[model samples]
Target: MADEKGRYSNAFTATLAGIADLFRKQKNAVVLSDDDVITGKNILITGASSGLGFEAAVQLARRGAHVYMACRSGIPEKGEKVMQHTGNRNVVMLPVDLSDIESIKKLVGQLKEAAVKIDVLIENAAVVPSGSRKTKQGIEEMFMVNYLSKFLLTRWLLDNNLFNTDGGSIPRIIFVSSESHRNPKAFDWDGFGKYKEYSMGKTVELYGYYKLLMTTYANELARRLNPTSQHRYSIFALCPGPVNSNIARESPAIFKPLLKIVFGIFFRSPKVAVQPVVYFAASSDVKDKTIDYLFLMSRKEMDAKATDVENGKKVWRLSEELLNQHGVVFQKSFPPRI
Candidate 1:
């Protein structure tokens, strides 16, 4: 199989691709109305310290949602900023290092201990590292942060009954995936969950693969959670397109100035790029759907590979097995086979 599929093989290519996408008319764009209110809804957002995640927290807070900022850094200060900007004091900061398994478990444990019943769980935490680095658990840092952490965190939440599913509104699980998810033609099944050294040259390629893993997992989670079209929970994944954010903070110094110019000139700001996420969190249009995806503000289908039943099942199984290998056990009976 090709190392990667489609156009986005590296940062330069990916940036160009995103820019090209912006020019295309969003024919299926769904407007987010000011009337869609999420007042008092307990929404948990990961990576809310900066960039798109931070903007999302602010916007959601402005809509009156009880925003929980789950992040690795920027504690009281970030939370305070959300309150300062939105005049909403329901925002709370919850620290979590997404690259570490123990830290994720600690975060979930803290939420459960506090009896926090989350209505909207936004899995927005992600990283684009300079090169391949190992987490404390000896897994690749990017893989752990960008994909596996979401799987582990969401599973623990469901297993512990942390989601407020009994409420009048169905709980929503939103993933900040990417259009790059379509760039990986296939999965690296043999190399799954194994750490191998690589440099920036291979970073974007692997990034797309991990995204495919995440998108696949999202589909499978929807299948398992809302079987027979019951639509118990709304599972959403979206590509916010390219946002001018700190996600590329680790780029080589020589290219930083150039990237800054290109991103500033072409990329959308975090505030503008976060509309789809806000729509998913607060909009009633998608409240009853089992699964949904968006590219920019327009509704779109996920890649065929991501939507494949066999691929989703295999990815789900492998992810569970990998976690088990790392000593993170699932206590409850998971979904029966599809």
Candidate 2:
């Protein structure tokens, strides 16, 4: 019989290996510097309690950027641990629950009150609920956390003028998506509400659907915003290859042991998995480009067929409507300067 690692093998691992191989082939690509200073930059990272998001926050702070970790429980102990590990003092913790719209609003409101401008926004938080769950806003759990919440948050930031920096440039918004957007089918729009039960497989499928939606929405928002001239805010959706993260622990108990074994052998470290995001956030090469989706560290275009521009527009409209219904009027200006 195949071992646990072999049993859970999928295309995600193959794709990551291919990307690593490509990096090796490019012998002259510039390597990252350990002393790069990102001083004066304010970055906000979601899901900073652990995994890739935590790594991203630590690394960004190490680069001299002020990092705000947005988590569900603003635990000072966890924040202290991250600061100690990274040896960076520019890290702060902000509590937020993406599943709840009000929590998101309060989080942003606090940032706004502080009069801090966000130079980079990483929508890295996600949830793969084991069973069918609904957010406080009565939306599908996966969709709310992985897709809609990001969309709403970005919209709010832009509208409130929190992302606009001096000299007419807007902050960057990076969406942590997945390669699973290439799946050949669209998700059932109403199924999220209809399903009252949950299973491991169902959770994975729902999460994949959210990734698809994210990729589609990223492109559409870029087009609508059209960052040019002074307000040069751009957006990029990134597909970080699978890594040894706790995301798999959300699976059924029967599958946890198997996934743990597989992830142990085949998954990349959280630090490595977040390289693409770090590069996108700080690299000078990609500055001001309205990229659709990036794979690894390369600026690869996503499958247009999979993104479905029409569907993306529909989703955007629906999102705006949803926010408006909740009495949340988002701003339209880039970076949303107050």
- Which candidate should be chosen as best, given TM-score against the real structure? 1
TM-score quality measure for candidate 1? 0.97
What lDDT does each candidate get? 0.91, 0.72
For 1-338, candidate 2 gives per-residue lDDT tens digits of 11112212233443344345334443223335565567769999999888889889878887878899999864776678778977777788999999899999998899999887998999999876767787776776777888889888888777777885678666788999876666535556564333256565556555666777787778777766763444366787877776788776556677677677767776778888888888878877667576645665555557564456577677677677776776877656332111
- How many clashes does each candidate structure show, in the order listed? 0, 6
lDDT of 1: 0.91
Candidate 2 ranges with C-alpha deviation above 4 Å = 1-36, 187-198, 227-231, 306-308, 331-338
Candidate 1, position 110, lDDT: 90
lDDT of 1 by residue, 214-252 (tens): 999999988888777566888999999999999899999
Q: What are the C-alpha RMSDs, in order, of all predicted structures?
A: 1.8, 5.3
Each prediction's TM-score versus the true structure:
0.97, 0.85
What TM-score would candidate 2 get against the native?
0.85
